[model samples]
Target chain A: MRYVLGLDGGGSKLLCVIADETGRMIGSSLAGPTNSSYNTPEEIELSITSVISEILANHNIARQDVSIVYGALPADGQLSISTITKNLHDGVKVNLCGEYVLSLFGAIQEDYGAVVQAGTGSFAHIRTPKTEITVGGWGPILGDEGSGYYIGKNALMACVRMADELGIFTILQERILTYCKQVKMRDLCTLIYATPSNKQSTLIASLCPIVGKAAAEGDKVAIDILEDAAEMLFMQASSVLKLPDVEARFPLTVAGGVWKTNPLLFNCFSTKIKQLFPQIDLRYPLFEPVIGGVLLGLRDLGFPVKAKIEELKHHFSAYSISADLFQ
Target chain B: MRYVLGLDGGGSKLLCVIADETGRMIGSSLAGPTNSSYNTPEEIELSITSVISEILANHNIARQDVSIVYGALPADGQLSISTITKNLHDGVKVNLCGEYVLSLFGAIQEDYGAVVQAGTGSFAHIRTPKTEITVGGWGPILGDEGSGYYIGKNALMACVRMADELGIFTILQERILTYCKQVKMRDLCTLIYATPSNKQSTLIASLCPIVGKAAAEGDKVAIDILEDAAEMLFMQASSVLKLPDVEARFPLTVAGGVWKTNPLLFNCFSTKIKQLFPQIDLRYPLFEPVIGGVLLGLRDLGFPVKAKIEELKHHFSAYSISADLFQ
Candidate 1:
């Protein structure tokens, strides 16, 4: 029996796994961000090939034994099979898929459902047997409502606003100042502006957890910011529900760091979604998108995916559980 | 008679003028931004000295004959008299002050009023006979409501949101797409993120005028964004009014490119200000901050200011009437 491989590439990180026909995931690896939309074609190829090499070497599996490869990334035809299969077996089938499917199938067993995936960026993916659609995955400057960078950005802005008396007093100012080890607001602004563009997004998004913690402590300002973020996320979901092809009965679930970091956002999002579409079933994702990638690979390769999914789930209890594994 | 100099250094540009003791502004020049808070001390000194040399050389005046220099800048004690007067007369006097005073006196010709200065960023300054205080002006990342950057940023965000179907359709999507020559939303997001940090803020804020044009065309999204900016600006002013040192009746006027770009923002701001504080009088600024700097120099050095103010206004009618001269 040949082994099938699956790789899930995200906006900020990468994950890969290998499994035989029986559904047991034999190997897994983590790598840097590999989104073709954000990275160069050469960079994307290098990341993909390197991850393949490392996983094969670590698991002591031969590259030629892998009969098929399935990859999910935010790409737009930037990669080709001939390029990815270099130095390996000729004509090894490679399927380059969008990250949305990984998020969609990893969260639910059924084919008809929608998932709001919030990681470094955010988007809602709705899919059915016949069609699929996406909403609100614009990058930092354009949109990414309820995303990590957006939450962190608002927290920093609130600190400066309170200092200027333009906003009411909030614990974010004190928490952010102490976190950055800054005594004044101007320094914090400098830190954000001075950071090189390569690292600026992460620097901003890294503060997301702090905002979540602040909301959990009953800070009104933090709660308001989180609630607004949740409302925006709900708006994205509502936009998906408006699609003529999707009925109101489609199952909906939330995934990503923002939802798990704070219960308040999830509660707000769920409450709003129910208020608008009470018939739509809400499901907590059975698995995050990365694990969903592996399952997609198994089924696409004509393997027994259900038993393997159960076997792989039992084996990768830690790695395949969450969307934000590297964080 | 000795000549006196006034230099107003702003967040994005600098203006310098030379006037005779009798209130005649004989020479004026434009230079690059010289905010000490944002630029290095050496850069600040270079811009300052270069502007001084340009004005003096253009006017055919001897440096030694200029007895006093009145400079209003966004500085945090980054300059010294010895460093500034290195090549000039040994004992020549330099009166360095914060830019807020230039905004305060330029707009009202009186010491007791509040001026909301909107440029690349926005801030509110209130000075009564007894005390002076500032609200907002926390830079782009922190605060800057009603600022050019804020307006432009929101406009860009709206276009993408509309594309995702998360927001209602508006003329902004068409206007922005045509302006950027972009066929897709993803390319637009890349264009913004790929811009270098040095020119990024200016590039984003440049869209402020475009947003105003859209609002004038009756785009509801554009109008909503402008109204939000105006509301934030009103919040800054209200914060100033909350000060215990000043009564609520203080004159409140808006001065900046944003106020003059379109009448919509100013109308909204004025309506809200009056709705909350009817006794507070609203007046148009008599002169922009640069001309205010010249008048300040003339008066502070014990020279005639009022007659010169009228003379300068008549001769440089093109310059001093608005805060956005260099734009």
Candidate 2:
């Protein structure tokens, strides 16, 4: 039977899956980060090859049986397709795209829709029948509005302002200090400034949960920050929808750790978007991006997607249940 | 003749002036930066000694003749008075204070009033006859509202947003790219991400003049940045003024390179403050901050400051004119 491989490479980790032409998952594995912007080409190649090799070896499947490969890598930089594909086994056709593209595909299960991914960083991808557009993926220094990094950085600034007596006191101040193991404001400065630039984003992004927890507990400052973040994210989506020739009533999906973990932020975003664009048809993604990659591989193999969509969905649901029972 | 030395040690440069107790300027010199936060205590000591030695040698003055020394070091961190004093020549009494303190003394030529300094960093110091309060000097990451660093960083963010198509195209975008010698949006990203954190602030602050130039040439994005910056600074001043027991009608002085160089920003700040507090007694400083150091030294020497203020101001003006003519 002909099989395919699917990969989702993000900043922190990589997920891979192998499936039959009918979209039945046969093997899966996880590996380290493969973000091209943060990692060298050799590192990315190693990450991709190691995961694939592990799955193939575990399942006792020969390389020739895997007809095609689909990879959705973190949209950190302009990744070269040849560099990634050249390392794969012979006769395996590779299709490479950004992680956000796979996220959109995973959400709508089609080539058309809008997806706003707000994890450590935030970006929006809008795809139509004729056009595709992206917004707000300029990283922390430039953009990343409404991202976890943005929220966390703002929280730190609020603490400083409070310490300087320019802002009223808030619980966030104590929470942030304790979180950073700092007793004084100057110590916090030392902590932040002393961290390396490459590691600073992750360190700051880690503070998002603190802000979210505070917001959930009704802290005014924290709530304001989340609300502002939601507003900025919604504006990103609104900007895409308002673009000329783009449909206003297409499917909209919110993905990523920030949205999945913080229901208050998600709800705030939903309400703001609805208030602005009443006609938008928001939908929850049917599967993870790795599954979307599987679907892309199936399509490349000339499989009839429309007829198998319902069957594949049912199969994955059952597969998940069986996997959980064994665990 | 017995002379008093006044030293203003900042992040970029050190300014020292020697004048007799009667406030007659005898010698002055400049040296490298000695910001305590960015430099080691040893480095600061070395900078201080270098400038003092240069001025003394140039004017043929002895260390024993400099009986009183007042140095205002930038309030980047907690400066040690003993460490600095121990290195100075014996019999020379030293009084040390924060840069903000001397800025206030220079602007009002007295111990009371408010001074908002907006240089590479921004801070406000308000001194009442009985109490003193400070606001918003938390460095670049936390606060620096209307500072050159603030403006420059905001300008960089604007360029990123514009490049991502999240913001409208502006002339400031091209100006920033050209200033950084970046050819594409990706190049800008690499440039910023590769810069070391310690050097990043200086690099970002260097972009301030480009923003100022763009604003002067009627760029909407640049103008808005300056306006927002001015409003933030005015808010800092307004916050301190509204503090309980703080006098509302004291002389207010705006100091630092940001206010000194950008007339448009200065006007915006002035208009905002006047609109909020019409009773404020705004005044131009009689001399530069190093001269404020001179006045402080004279105060420590039991000199009559009230009688010498006018004479010192006149002497410095004449001194500057003669130096320029001779050069």
What TM-score do all the candidates reach, one by one? 0.88, 0.83
The DockQ scores of all candidates, in the order shown, are 0.60, 0.48
**lDDT by residue (tens digit), candidate 1, B1-327:** 787777787657778877777777687877777766568877777777788888888989888888877677765443635545863577677877766666666776666788888777888988888888888876666678789889988998888888887678878877777888888877878888788665667777888888888898989999999999989888889888777766656787767777778578888888888898787877777776666666776776785555556675675475565533212
Clashing pairs in 2: none
Poorest stretch of ten by lDDT in candidate 2 chain B? B318-327
Off by over 4 Å in 2: A1-7, A10-68, A72-91, A164-169, A184-186, A275-279, A301-327, B20-22, B26-30, B35-49, B74-88, B158-171, B174-190, B209-221, B317-327
Candidate with maximal TM-score: 1
Q: Write the residue-wise lDDT of candidate 1 on A272-327 in tens digits.
A: 98899897888766676666766776786776656555666676576555534212
Candidate 1 scores a chain A TM-score of 0.90
True contacts kept of each: 0.79, 0.59
lDDT of 2 by residue, B57-150 (tens): 9999877788887788764333435544554565677778777677777666778888888888888888887788888877776678888889
TM-score of chain B of each: 0.90, 0.88
What is the TM-score of candidate 2?
0.83
Highest-DockQ candidate: 1
